[model samples]
Target chain A: MADDQICPKCGAPLPADVAPGHCPKCLMQVGFESQDQAVADPAEAPTAVSGHSGVTWDLDQLASLFPELEIIKQVGIGGMGVVYQARQKQLDRFVAVKLVRPDLCDDPTFSERFTREARAMARLSHPAIINVFDFGQREQFYFFIMEFVDGTNLRQLMQSEGLDATQALAVVPQICEALQYAHDEGIVHRDIKPENILVDTKGRIKIADFGLAKLINPEATDFTLTGAKQVMGTPHYMAPEQLERPLEVDHRADIYSLGVVIYEMLTGELPLGRFSSPSEKVQIDVRLDEVVLRALQKEPEKRYQQVSGIKTDIEAVSASPTGHSPRQSVVPPTVRQAFNNLQYPGYGLYCVVNC
Target chain B: MDDAGFPSPHSGRFATTRWSIVQAAGVQATPNSRHALEELCATYWYPLYAYVRRRGYQADDAQDLTQSFVLSLLERNAVQRADPDRGRFRSFLLGSLNKFLSDETRKQGAQKRGGDRKILSINVDDVENRYQLEPTDDITPEAVFERRWALTVLDAALTRLQGDYERVGKLPLFEALRGHIGADKSTIPNREVAESLSMQEGAVKVAAHRLRQEYRDALRAEIAQTVTNSKELDDELTGLFQTLSGT
Candidate 1:
C-alpha cells in the first residue's frame, strides 16, 4: 500500500500530488481522516481469511478437519471437487467424502449452495440414492460424507460388457426407482447420464453424486446463458426440451434423460435423430419402443409426466416373464393411466415387480 | 483433472455471472448483444487509455488512439479471437491494446476516429486530469495499465458501496466511516464515530462491522467481474497490489 497514498478504495495509487482526497482512478472520496473504522463480523465470515489459502490440504489438515474419520484413500475427483474413501471411526464403516476445492472454500454463496444440496440429499431416505453419512462445513472446505458404494459404476460395467436387454431391465428399473423417489420428493437430478449411474460388484444400483451438479452447473448454466449457446449434458442423452427451453426444466427432464439412459443401455446407442428403436438395435421387446420413445420425447408434456410412469412400464416389461406379450399397444392412454394403480410410487411394487 | 471427474478450479462464481457474459459477448457480439460489450468497453477504456498515454503518446493522440482502438477492435470483430475460458479480460484487453499500438505505430500519423457512434463516453479533460495523478518516470506502460485497471475495478466497487449507502440514505455514515473501511480503528475510538453518527458506541461497532462485510463482498464481486476462474482471482488480486506499488 506504499502507493496507497494513491487510494485504497480504488486500488488507485493516484499521484501523491493530486488534490489530496479525491480518488483520481474511480473519482471517489479518499485520504480523508475520518475516525470511523470497519469492524469484522466474526459470525458472518465463517473462516479466518488468513488460514484459507492452501492449494491442497495436507494430510494433517484433513485429519484435523474430520478427527473421527481415518483418511484412508483418494477415491476420485469430479468437475466440482475431490472424493476420498474414508472410514468413519465410530461406525467402522467406509464412506466416500467429497471435499469442495480449496479455492472455492472462500465463496460464501458456493458454501451456502453446497449446504443446500447436502440438505436436499439428506431429506431422501431411499437406499438406491447414495446415503449421506455426514456433511458440514469445517476448517475451510465443505465435505459431504456419503455411503461409498464398493462397486464399479454402470459406465465401467458397460465398458467391460455392455448390459443386455434383460440386464438393463433389471438395472434401469432400479434407477427409475431412485429417480421416482427423488422426483416425488421434488428433486431433479438434472445431469442423469451413464456416468452418474453406479453399479456395485454385487449388482446393487446406487445413484451416486446427487447434488454434485449444482456447483458444476455453473459451467453449464454459463454456456446456456452465454454465446456457447450449448446446454450442459452429454448432448446425446439430454432431453431436447432441456436445450430448447432450459429454464422450464423440471422433474420430467430427469425422466427424459433417464429414457436416454435406457436407450443407451438397451441399444448401446444414444436416441439421436431418427434413432432406431431399442428393439431394432438389438433383440428386445418392441413394446419398449413405446416406453423409450415416450420418455425421450421432445416435448416435456409428451414425455413421462412422472418418473414412476417409466418405472411402471419398465417393471411391467420385466414382470411379463418373457413371451407374455402384454399388447403391442404400449403407449399408455393418459399420464395417470400410464402409472395406473401404482400405489406408493416406485418404492415397493416397482422393486418387487422387477425383483 | 483427477479420477472422479473434477474439472480444474470449477470457474467458481458462474459463467452466467457478469464477467462471463462480457467475455461471451466479446467473442461474437451481435447488434443486439453489442451493448453488453460496449458496457464493458466503457468501464475499462480508461486503463487502456492511461496505458497508451504512458506509452509516450501525447494527450490528444493517446485519446484518439484509445477510442479508435477500442471501436476498431469491436468494429473489426478482432476481439472475437479471445477465448474467455482460456484467458482473462485484462490480459486479453492489454494484449489487444498493445497490438493496436504497434499496428498504429507502423501505420504512423493519426487514424480517423468515427464521430458517429461514441461507444465509450470517455470525458477527455476528466481522463487527462485523472492521468495527472499517476506517478512519473518510474513504471512501464504495461505496469501502469495494470495499476490503472486495478484501480478502476477498485473504484467500481467503492462506487457501488457509495451508491448502496446513498440509496439507503446513509451517505453521511459512509462518508464518515469510509476512511477506515479496512484500516485499524484503535487510534480513533468508536466513541468518536458514535458521537458523530449520534449512535451508541456498540451500535457504531456493529455498523462498522456490517460495512466491512459489505465492502468485502463488494470487492469480491467486483474482482469476480475481472476473473473467470477462482485460480485467476488470487493471481489478479496479487498482481493488483504489486502493480499499484509500481512493481
Candidate 2:
C-alpha cells in the first residue's frame, strides 16, 4: 500500500490522488514530444519494447566508423553507404564524404573495382564534374570524398516545378562538357539520369556521381543512392542499348540519357513515343530538334558517337533564334521496342506524367 | 570502493533515493542529512571519474581534479540547489561536473583543489586499469558521459542479479546461461545448457527466460534511480544499449 505512494520517475512520494497520466514534475517538464504531454502510462512498458527496438538505429555511430571526419549532418543516404556533410578536421575543409555500407564492400572483387573506379574518378578534375577530392577505406566501410555542391539535384528542381528554357539550356551544355571529359578519360557514367546532375546555388551545373552505378550494382544498394524509387521512371531516360545489352554500353549511352534529360526539362514530360520534340512541348529554340533526336537514336553507334559532338550540336542550337519550326525527322520503329525492354514499370510513370 | 558500506539502495528507503533525498533535504543540508548526500555521491561518482579521465587528463591529474571537484561540490552544496523536477540526477551531476571542470581550468590546473584536503576516497589507483578496458575510439565528452552512466547502470544490475541468483543457490544455473544471454537461439544450443545444468531442455529455456526477466527488472530498478521519471528510463536505456553495441 505504501509502495503505490512513491513516484516512479524521481522516486519521491507521489502526491495523493494526482491525475493518472502526467508526472506533475518530469513529463510536464519538457516542451518536448507530444507523447510526453499525453501521459500514456508505461504500465504496459515491456509489451512496448518490441515496437521500440529500432531506437538504436541512427547515423550517430559514425563517430567511431569515421574518426578523422566529424559528421556535421547527414546529407543523403544511398545503397553504398551514407553521404555525410563533414569537416575533415586534419585538412579543415568542408566535404561531402560518401561512405558505402559495409555489406556492399564485402566482396574482394567489388572492393578492387571500387578502388579502380574511385581512382579513375579522382583523377577526373573538371569544373563541370563534381571534383573527387580523395577516397579510400575508413574502417570496414569505404568512403569517397568530393567537393560538396551547395545546390539541389536536377530531379528535385524539375520535379518541384520545371526549369526555365534558358536555365535548361545552360545546364545541358555543361553536362555535355562533363560527360565529354569523362568519356575522354574512358570512364562512362552508366547512370546519367537527371538525378545524377546537380545545379548549384550559382546555377553552375555539374555532373554528379559518375562511375558509382558501374562500380556497384544499383539493385543491391540503398534506394536513396540508387534512385530506385525515382528510377521507376529511369527507363524513360535510359538509352536503348543500355537497356537491351547493358554490358556493351559505352560513353554514347550517356549521350542518349542526356538527350532524354533535355527532352524532359524543356517539356516537363518524358520523351516517350507519340511525343513531340523539345520545342513542341515548350517554346525552346527549334534547332534543338535534330540534336535531341539524334542523341535519342535506337542504336548507340547511330547516336552522337562522342559527347563532344552532342556539345557542338547544343552550342549550335543555342546560337539559333527561338520560335522557328524544327525540320521533320522520321520516327524510328526500334526506339519504341527498346523502350519496353527497359525493365522498369515506366508505362505507369509516363501515364501519370502525360495525364 | 564497492557500495557495501552504504545502506542497500533497494531496501524500501529507495523512497529516499538520491533524487528524493536532495528534494527532501533542500538547500540547507543538516549534519543528519549528510549521510544520504554521501550515499548519493557514493553511488554516482565513478561515471564522473570516468568522464574527467576521458577529458584527456592523465592519471594523477584526473584523480586530483575529480577529488577536488567532488570536494568543491560538497563544500558548495551544489546538490541541495539542484531542482529535482527539472531533470535526471545523472544529468545534474554531469552538468555540475562540466561547470566545475570549466571553472577549474580558469582557476588553473591541480593547485590545492581539494578544499581543506578532504579525503573523498575515489579508488583512482584502480581507475586507470579499469579505464584501459574501455573502447579506445574517438568519442565526445557528451557521449562518454552517456556511455559511462549506462555502463554503470548495467554493471549495477548485473551485480545485483548475480547476488540474487547466488542467494537462491542457483549460482551455477546463472553462470551456465550467462554466456548465452547475449547469444541468439542459433548460437546457443538449449541442449548444451540442459546437459550442463542437468535439466530438461525445456526447463533450461524457462530458466533462461526467468534470468532474462529478472535481469530486465534489475535494470529497470537501476535506471529508475538516476532518471526524473519513468518516461525517461527507456530513453536512457536506449542510449546505453547504443553505446554498448557500438563496438
Candidate 3:
C-alpha cells in the first residue's frame, strides 16, 4: 500500500498512519480514504487547526514499556506533553501518565534533561507531592507515570469556594512538608501555586509537576545557565532574586514560593511585586494583607527564611486572639478591615511586623 | 436519549431470561465448553459456588459440584424453567439452584456427564482466580454469592467500558470520567465535573450522558456475549437486571 499523504480531513500533511478522516488531534474528519466522496473545491476544505498538538501514542505500546502501568484516560495538554490517567496494573491502582512532547525528544540534550528530572522526581517519596512512579519511552514519546490524584487543584478549589483561615492553615503544613522533603533532596521546586497543589479525597494535599525543579550541584555551574533559567517559572511566584540573577539563586527561592502560597491562602490573593498582576485580583480579599506583604518581600534574605517558619507564622496568626476567631467558619469583618488597612492607601504599616 | 437507549426490561433492574440462560448454560456444557461455560459462570458462579461450599462441601468438591450443578441446569434449561410471574427471577434462580444441588447430592453415585458442544471460550484461570474463600463460617453461601455477584457485575461493566474506550482511542477521557460516575458529590458540595475535564457545565453534562449510554451499551454487549440465541440474550439480560436490583 502507498504511504498515506494529505491530511485525512483537510489535505495537509498527515502526521502518521492515522485513519483517513479529519486529523485526530484536530476534530477534522473528511477526505483522504475515498476521493470520490471528497469535496474537491479547495475553497470549501475545512481549515480547522488541530485543537491538540499532533502528539499521539498507542496505549498498548506504553503498556509494553511500563509493564506495571495501564493507561486510564488522557487528562489534558500540558506545556510539554499530553497527560493520561493510568492504572498500575501490577499494583491494581490508578496513576497519571504524562507523555513528553515528541519533537522535543529529537533534541538529545533536552530529552536527557527531561527523563533525568522525571527519574529524580519519581525517587521523591512524599504524601504532599504528586508521586511519580516510573518513566519510559514508547513509540518516540517519553512517558512518566504519576499517582492519579482524584481531586481538584487549589486554583479550582479557591475559584468555587474561597479559602477559609482553618482550611488555609490546614494546607500550609502539607505544602511545607512537600517542599521541605524536596529541598532536603537538593531539588528546588521553582513552581508552587494553587494550580500545582492537588487536594485529593480526604482533603490530602499533593503538589504536582516537578517539571521546573532545579537540581543544585556546585560542579555543574554551567548547567544552571543551560535552559534552566530562561522564563522557567510562574512570574508571580518567582523569587525576586531569580528574576534579577537566575544562576545565583538556590533552595531559598522555593521557601519564598511557599511564603507566597501561605500568603494567598490567608488573603485569597497572590502577593504583589513591584510588578505582580492577575486579571482577577479584585475578586481576592486581602484579609491578612499584612502577612502576605512580608512574604512577598523582594529580597530573599528579607522573606521568610524557611517553609517551616512560614507555616509556623501562619499557624500563629490563625491562633491569635485578636485576629480571626477560631470558632468562626468565616473570617470576620473586623479582621477583614484590619487586613485591608495593612494593604490599602498610602499606609505602609502591616500587622506589627518584627522583621 | 430515549428509554430504548436505557436498558430494556431484558436489560433493566430485573431480568429473568438472563438468569435462566445462565442457569441453563451452566448445567448443560461439557469440559471444552469449560471456558465458554466459565465466562457464563461469572455472574452466577460465585453465588452458586458459595452456596454449595456453605452447604458442607469441601473447597475443591464445592467447585466441582457447583460446576456440575451449572452443567445440569444448562442441559435442562433450568433458567427457561423460571416462572417470574409465580415469583421473581432472583427467587426462581436460587430455588432452582437449590433443587439442582439437592438432586445432585441424592444422585451422588450417578456418572457426571457434560455436553459435547462448546458454547463460548472463557478464560477459566481468570474466572477461578477471581474467587476468594469466605473469611468466616458465619456468612451464608447465598449472602457471599450475592455480594460477589454484585462486585463482579460492576467490575465487568468497568472492564467493558475500558475495552471500548481503548478500541475507540478515547481511554483518557473515559478514565477522567470514571471516578465521577455513580459517585456521591455531597461532601464536595460545589464540586463540578466540568472543572476536571476543563469543559463548561453543559458540555460535562453531555459527556456524562454519552458515557452512561456507552457504558450501558458495553454492558449489554457483555451480557450478549455470554448467551447463544436471541431469546437467550433477552433472558440473560432480564436476569442481569434482576441481579442489579437484588430482586
The top-ranked prediction according to DockQ is: 1
Model 3: runs farther than 4 Å from truth?
A1-54, A57-68, A211-230, A272-290, A324-355, B1-247
**Quality of candidate 3 docking, DockQ:** 0.01
Candidate 2 C-alpha lDDT tens digits along A311-339 = 78777767775554433323243443443
Once model 3 is optimally superposed onto the true structure by TM-score, how far is the C-alpha of residue B59 displaced, in angstroms?
55
Q: Pick the candidate with the highest TM-score.
A: 2
Rank the models by TM-score, top first: 2, 3, 1
Model 1 sits at an interface RMSD, in angstroms, of 19.5
Q: Using Cα atoms with residue i matched to residue i, what is each candidate's TM-score against the true structure?
A: 0.44, 0.45, 0.44
- DockQ (C-alpha based) per candidate is 0.04, 0.02, 0.01
Could you give candidate 3's per-residue lDDT for residues A125-232 as a string of tens digits? 887888887777766667777788866667556643557656777788778778878878877776675667887645778998764434221223332454332234
**Candidate 1: which docking quality band?**
incorrect
Where in model 1 is the C-alpha error above 4 Å?
A1-54, A57-61, A102-108, A218-234, A321-355, B1-247
The candidate 1 chain A region of ten consecutive residues with least summed lDDT is A37-46
- Which docking class does model 2 fall in? incorrect
Scored against the native two-chain complex, candidate 2 gets a DockQ of: 0.02
- Model 3, position B161, has a per-residue lDDT of 75
Clash count of each predicted structure: 13, 9, 33
Q: After superposition, how far is residue B206 of candidate 2 from its true place, in Å?
A: 60
- The Cα RMSD in angstroms, rounded to one decimal, for candidate 3 relative to the true structure is 20.5
